[model samples]
Structures are given as structure tokens and as C-alpha cells.
Target chain A: MTHLKTKHRLLADKAMLWIVCLFATLTAVPLFAILGEVLLRGYDQLSWSFFTETTPTAYKAMKAIEAGEPIPGGIANGIIGTMIMLGMAAIVAVPTGILCGAFLAENPKNRFSQTVSYLTDLLQGTPSVIIGIVTYMWVVVPMKGYSAIAGSVALFVMMLPLIIRSTEETLKILPASLKEAGLALGGNRARVMLKVQLPAAFGGIFTGVLLAISRVIGETAPLMFTALGCSFIRFSIDKPISAVPLLIWEFFNDPNLQELIWGASLFLLLFVLTLNLTAKYLAKKWNQ
Target chain B: MESVKPILEFNKTCVSYTKQTMAVKYVSAAIDRNTITAIMGPSGCGKSTLLRAANLMHELYPNIRVDGEILLNGENILSMEPVDVRRRIGMVFQRPAPFPTMSITDNVLAGYALNGIRLSKAEREETVERCLKSVALWDEVKDVLNKKGTFLSGGQQQRLCIARALAMKPDVLLMDEPTSALDPIATAHIEKLMQELQKEVTILIVTHNMGQAMRISSKSMFMYLGELVEYGDTATMFSTPKDERTKAYLTGRMG
Candidate 1:
């Protein structure tokens, strides 16, 4: 009887394993499907000029379509704008996030830190659309026009919670003995944090920063309200800008420019995928 | 002539994790300078707690209270700044922890770096060499000074931790079962290292291994249930413990 029961149980376990594998494959299918569709549709549009030139006007795109030629001009303006805004956001957010994370991790029981930690969670859960409107009111309105600075302020708000949470969590998981040993050496809290804890947590914090940038890179609603839209390549941050997602949205709106949509989407998707993969790889290498 | 004052003195030191329960209760003892003293006990016997109190490790936790005076060189350490007191004292934990981010040489010089005390290149080299030599690790790790200390073998890593502590040239070294996590050979290596280290710095070590206490320590303390049960010369305590609890523990009849 026992032998029979063991055989039945093993069969059940095998069935469960197969079911889980099927579900896992089902979950992965859409990711590959999206990659395949985007690659096929966008590969022809990619070229040297496609990356170098700014977006073509709707009239130019219509003229190109009538001539039976590929749309002339690329997403240089959007790419440059995204880079500038990301740089600005990371510059302000990284240090502030790390310090706040240190405070939260070091004082887990303090009432103020607990409140701040809770607020960070709430901020992370907030909708991107709401954040965009808030940025418009606080930044675009104040500056008297939509600007790259306003766009970055929205990205900064979005990135802050992620960096803080990662830094805090990484520091928290480290063996308490590490901190004790540092302190036992007579190192003050600040020096120990700077020299020991932060260095130890660098992998996780850096991964979080990369993940944060990837997270905000595809944001269109926030950029819509803050950066508005610019047709030409612009360098000055106080004026309007165009990001990759914004270009995709713009392409979606114009019938003649619709062929460029997949290219922008593919570029954004590939960039985010690479960032996520690099973050994972660096995290693994650093841990060892 | 009057006898020299003890290097470290615990005057009725008490450590309580809470307001109601005391982990260490009125444990009074004095340690002679440049001698090895072993604190032996079973698990949860407050031996480790007593050792941690000497270094003010209790300060990190908010609720855990350490009362009574811990004096170093006849000055009360409980009131002194934790950083100031810790500078004069060093510690090694059970598991070997050579800063993961640091190289072997940098691990040795971590105390200086953490204190923001810059050393000339020559002085840094000398201190690393001297400290590693004292821990018997200079020969093994000299070539891989740039490699991260985490790459070393367990015993070698433990020795590196010891070297890191020795680099500070502290007055007292508190070790909380530094060899407990090692294999027999590694444990023996640390035991032998401690014997040599005592000549330069006063050593207070917590161990559950009775043979280890008998092997290296000149003085022995046996604690039971948060109280110091016995304190005397090692030979005397091993041969004839005055307290019943101490004898029971040594004879393996009680924990």
C-alpha cells in the first residue's frame, strides 16, 4: 500500500512540474513575440541618417511617402533630449536618494525614518500621470514654459524612491558583524558609511540607479506635460525637448509619420532591456 | 612597591537586553596587562556579552543597556566617547570578516583609513608588514596584497582579521570566540596566534572550548546564566573549581 501511494505521489509531482513549466513558457511567449514583431517592422527603417537626423515634419514625411521612399531624418533630437534629461535627473537624485536610504537603514526604529520610509513606498506607487501633472504645475508653470528641466524634475521624483529602497535593503541585508567590526575599530558612523557600508552596497545601489533610469526612460505622459514637444534638435535645457517615447507618441498621431513608430519603440525597448540585463550582470559579478 | 594596576577592570558590569532581563549581572573582574584571559561558558552564558561590553559594542543597539563601570587603565570607559574608547581597544568576531571591498593590505590598514588618518606609503607598507607578520600571515599573503581579503582561505582570512586589529596597536583586544567557526586545524592556528599576540597586547577572549581556555589562557573566567561563576588562575580553575557550577561545566556534567 505504501509503495502504491509513493508511486501515485511521484506521478502527481511530475504533473505539477509540467504544469509549472507550461505556465512559465506561456509567460515568456509575449516578451519574445513583442521583440520579434518590433524587430521585423523596425529593422528596415534603421540607418545612419535615421540616427543622425532630426525627426522629419509631417509634410516632408507625406512627400517621402508619395515618392515611395523611406521617411527622411532620424530621432537624434529625442535621443539627445532623453540623454540630457536623464543626466540631470541622475545628478540630483542619486546622492539625495543614497543619503536618505542610509538614514532609513541606520535608524529603522526611529519614528521620523519610519514615516519617510512609508512615504517613499507611497511615492513609488504613485501614478506616472499624476506625477506629470504635478510637475507641470510646479515646474512648467513656474518656468513660464515647458522645459527639459521640468521633464528631468519628474524623472528625478520617479527615480528617488527606487534608489533609496535598494540602498536601504542592501545595507540592511549585510551582516551586522561588518558594521560592528568597523565601529570596533573606532571609525565614526560617517566614515564607516563612506568607506565601508556604501562601498559594500555599491553594486545594489548602482543596479538600482540603472533600473531607475530604464524605468523612467520610456515615460511619455510626464514628458508630455513638462518637455511638451520640439521638432528640432535643441541643446538648452530651459526650452522644450523631445524624448524617444514622445517621438513614438508623435508618430502615432501623424498618419504619414506612423511608419517611424516601431523604430522609436524598438529603440526604447532595446535600451531598457540592455540596462536591465547589465544591471543584473553587474549585481551578480559584484556579489561574488 | 605597589602592584601595577590592571589593564582592564570590570566593576560589577551589567548588560541587559531589556529593562527586565539582564544578560550579564554584576560581573566584576580585573585583567593584568599583556596577559591572555579566556572567558569560558556554554551558549547564552553572557561570556560574549561581557566581552562586548568592554568595547562598548552595546552602544549600537538602543534598547540593550550596559550599566556599571568598565574601566581601561583605571579610567571609566562607560562615559568616554565610544569612538575614543574603541580607538584604544580592538576586537575580532567569531566569523572572519576582513572588509569585503578591501584588498589584503588595505584590510590591514582599514582602521587607519576608517579613522581618516592618512599614512605615507612607506609607513603604510611597514604597518601592514609588521601586523601581518605578528599574525603569521605575512608569508602567505605578501604576494597577493592587492587581492581582496575575501579570497583567502577561512583560517587565512581569520588571521587577516587579526592582523587588521593588530595594526591599530590597541591597548586591549577583545575576541568573541574568534576560533569557534573554524576547523580543528584553523582553531589551533588561531589558538597558537593568540599565545604569541598576548606578549604585545592584553587579550580577553570568549570561548566555549574548555581545552582552548586551558591551552592558551593564563587566567580563566567561567560564567553561568549571566553571572561570573569562577575567576582565578587557569590551572587552579581547571584542577579545582571553587564554584559548583564551574566544576559542573568543566566536567561536562552541566551546560
Candidate 2:
């Protein structure tokens, strides 16, 4: 009876292992499918002009289709606008988020800090669409028009909690001896944080910032409410701006420009993929 | 002959984590200058707590309360700013923690940097060489001064931590089980270093190793259950412990 039971348990263990492996493979199926589909559909449209030229107008796209020629322009306007907005949002969020995280880590038990920590969680959970609408009311209306500034404000709001959480967690996990050693050397709290704690946490915080940028890069709802999408490449922050995701949405809505959607999507997907992979690589390197 | 004043004194020093529990009971001791004193006890006996009180480390926690007087050069440190007190009293913890982000040379000068004291390029080099040499880590690390401190071996890292503390020229160096995490060979190296160090600064070391206390310290204090059980010369304490508890702990009968 005991021999029979042992054999049965071994069989169950093998079955469990197989089940886990099968589920793991199942989980990766959608990611590979998306990458494959986007690559297949988007490869032809990707060209030198696709990166340098502004989006072709609906009339122009229709004319190109009628003549059996490819679209004349690319998503240069969206690329530039995304870069500008992301840069602006990062400039504000990185420092503010790190400082807030440091405060939370240093005073884990303080009533005010506890409340701020709770608020950070709430802010992180707030939907991107809601943030877009809120930014629209707060920034776009006050400026009397949709602008890149408003779109960046929405992205900034989305990025802050992510950066703050990462910084706080990174700082917290550091051996208490490091901070104590700094303090024992007669350094004040602020100096210790700047000289020791923040430098030590650079990797985690940088990874967090990259992840935040990737997360907001494809946000169309927020941009729709704020930047509102522009056709021509423009540098002005106070004007309606285009983004890669915004261009893809525009392509989806317009029948004549439908062929351009996959190319724009592939660009956005590739950008996000690169950022995520770099962040992961850096995080692993930092651990070592 | 005129008697020299003690460099540090704890007059009824008490550390309480909460109202209900006192980690270190009112424990008073006087430390002579330029001598190594070891605080020895079993785990949870408050030897480490009493040493932490002298450095005002208890101040970092909101719930921890340190009462009575810790006098440095006859001034009450409890009333002084933590920064001012810590500068004069250096500390080394159980683990060898060299700042992972900083180079070995930078780690030596971290005290000055953290205090916002700018050093000339010449002065920076001199200080780093002087501190590392004092800890006997200069020759091994001089070629790789620009390398991160974490690149060093465990024993080297502990010595680097000591060098970092010594860079500030503190009057009293508090080492809380500094070699507890090190191997036997590394522990011996640090113990020897402490003997040479006592000529420059008063050393207060907390150790669980009775053999180490006898080997390095001129004076010894044995604490148990948050109270000082005995205080005397290391030789006398090891050979002729007065308190029943100290005798029990020294004999490995009580922990």
C-alpha cells in the first residue's frame, strides 16, 4: 500500500509541474501574437520619410490610394510631441517624486506621512481617463485651448506615484546601517539622504522613471483631452500636439488613412519595449 | 599626582523603547581617555542598547526615549544637537557597511562630505591616505582607491568603515559588535587594530565574545537584563567576576 502511495504522489508532482509550464506558456501567447501581428503589418510602411515627414492629410491619403501609391508623409509630428511632453513631465516628476519618497521612507510612522502615502496609492489607482479629464479642466480651459503643457501635466500626474513608490521602497530596503553610519559621521538628515541614500537608490529610481514613461507613452485618452492631436510637426508647447498613440487613433477613425495605423503602433510598441527591456537590464545590473 | 578627567561619563543613562519596557536601565559608567573599554553581555541583555545611548542613536527612533546624562568633555550630550554629539563620537555597527555607491577614497572622506566641509584636492588625498593607513588598509587598497568600497573583501570593508569613522577624528569610537559578522581571522585583525587605535581615541566596544574582551579591552563592563552587573579591569573581571550573574555568564551557565 505504501509503495503504491509513493508512486501516486510522484505522478501528481509531475502532473503539477506540467500544468504550471503549460499555463506559463499560455500567459506569453498574447504578447508574442501582438508583436508578430504588428511587425507583419507595419514593416512595409516604415521608411526614412515615415520618421521625418508630418502626417498626410485625409485628402492626400485618399489621392495616394486612388493613384495606387503609398502615403506621402509619416508621424514625425507625433514623435516630436511625445518626446517634448515626456521630457517636460519627467523634468517635474523625478525630483518631486524622489523627495516625497524619501520623506515617506524616513518617517514611516508619522501621521502626516502615512496620510501622504495613502494618497499616493489613491493617485496611482486613479484612471488615466479621469486624469486626462481633470487636466483638461485644470490646464486646457485656463489656457483657453488644448496644449502640450496640459498633456504633460496629465502624464506627470501618472508618473509621480510610480517614481515615489519605487524610491521609497528602494530606500527602505537599504540596510539601516548605511544611514546610521552616515549619521554617526555627523551628517544631518538631508545631507545623508542626498549624499548616501539617493545615490545608492539611483538604479531603482531610474528604472521606475523609465517604466512610468513607457506606461504613459501610449495613453491616447489623456492626450485627446489635452493635446487634442495636431497634423503638422510643431514645437510650440501652447499648441495642440500630436503623439504616436494619438496618430494611431486618428488612423483608426479615418478610412483613407487606415494603412498608417500599424506603422504608428509598431513605433509606439517598439519604443515601450525598448524602455521596459532597458529598465529590466539596468535593475538586474544594479542588483549585482 | 593630579588625576586626569574622564573623557566620557554615563550618569544614570537609561533607554526605554516604550513606557512599559526599558531596554537599558539607569546604567552609569566613567570612561578614561585613550583606553579601550568593552561592554559584554548575552543577547538581549542591553549591552548594545547602552552603547547606542552614548552615541544618541536612540534619537533616530520616535518611540525610544533616552534619559539621564551622557557627558562628553563634562558637557551633557542629551541636551546638545545630535549632529554635534555624533561628530565627536564615532560608531561602527556589527556588519561591514562600506557605502556601495562611493569609491574607497570617497568612502574615507564621506564624513567631511556629509558635513559639507569642502577639502582641497591635496587635503582630500592626504586625509584618505592617513585614515586608510591608520586602519592598515592603505597598501592593499591604494592602487584601487577609485574602485567602489563594496569591491573590497569583508574584513577590508569593515576596516574601511572604521577608517571612515576615524576620518572625523572623534573623541570616542563606539563599536557595537564590529567583528561579530567577520570570520575568526578577520575578527583577530580588527581586535589588533583596536589596540593600536586606543592611543588616539577612547574605544567603547560591545561584544558577545568574552575572549575578545579579555584580549583587547583594558577595562570591561558586563550588563544583564538592562542593568550593569559588573565593571572592572578586564583581567580582574575575567579572573574574579564579583556578581553572581557575571560569573554565570562568564562561565556559560547563564545567557
Which structure among the candidates has the greatest lDDT? 2
Q: What are the clashing pairs of model 2?
A: none
Displacement of the residue A270 alpha carbon in candidate 1, Å = 0.5
Q: Which residue segments of model 1 deviate by more than 4 Å?
A: B1-3
The true-versus-predicted C-alpha distance at residue A271 of model 1, in Å, is: 0.5
Candidate 2 has what TM-score? 0.98
lDDT of 2 at B179: 96
Instruction: Report the Cα interface RMSD of each model, rounded to 1 decimal.
Output: 0.6, 0.5
Question: Tens-digit lDDT track for model 1 on A105-141?
Answer: 9999999999999999999999998999999999999
Per-candidate DockQ values are 0.91, 0.93
Which candidate number maximizes DockQ? Answer: 2
Tell me the tens digit of each residue's lDDT in model 2 across A160-225.
999999999999988899999999999999999999999998998899889989998999898899
Residues B156-215 of candidate 1 have per-residue lDDT tens digits of 999999999889999999999998889999889889999998989999999989899999
Chain B TM-score, structure 1: 0.98
